[model samples]
Target: MTKNDEKYLIEYINLKRHEYLNDLQVLLGYAQLGKMDKIFEYIQKVIDKCNDERTVFNSDMDSIMKYIKNKIEDK
Candidate 1:
């Protein structure tokens, strides 16, 4: 790919990464509020979106979701 194309891809990935992080933050907020159902629902939605998009960060998403699940269970 051309440098310009690579640059665009990098930007797109960064934007998506930020969006995912925001979702995780929201999930954490829900968890802190003791909204277990909301936490599960939100995480499922994230997983669904990642599956649909087939993004490069699917593994990262899985790892984060697992971490969140463990945190919830620990509480």
Candidate 2:
């Protein structure tokens, strides 16, 4: 909620956006080279990495919710 926190969050989002754009460019290069196998492998790797990130995000949210739930249980 603080201005500093907001600024950091915005920076993080922009950094991630740039990273995704770079990834797409890499994929485009592979396609231009007609490397079908490499393209598929790269795509699979990206998907797997995204899935792993999602799992970590989910677990983090679960922990936050658990803390809130425990607080409510005590009231």
Clashing pairs in 2: none
Residue 39 of model 2, lDDT score: 90
* For every candidate, C-alpha RMSD to the true structure in Å: 12.5, 9.8
Window of ten residues with lowest summed lDDT in model 1: 66-75
- Cα lDDT tens digits for candidate 2, 4-70: 5456556656665877898899899999999989999999988997786666557765553443344
Model 1, position 53: C-alpha lDDT score: 59
Off by over 4 Å in 1: 55-75
Q: Which number leads on lDDT? A: 2
lDDT of 1 by residue, 27-68 (tens): 889988999999989889988976865543455855544443
Candidate 2 worst ten-residue window by lDDT: 66-75
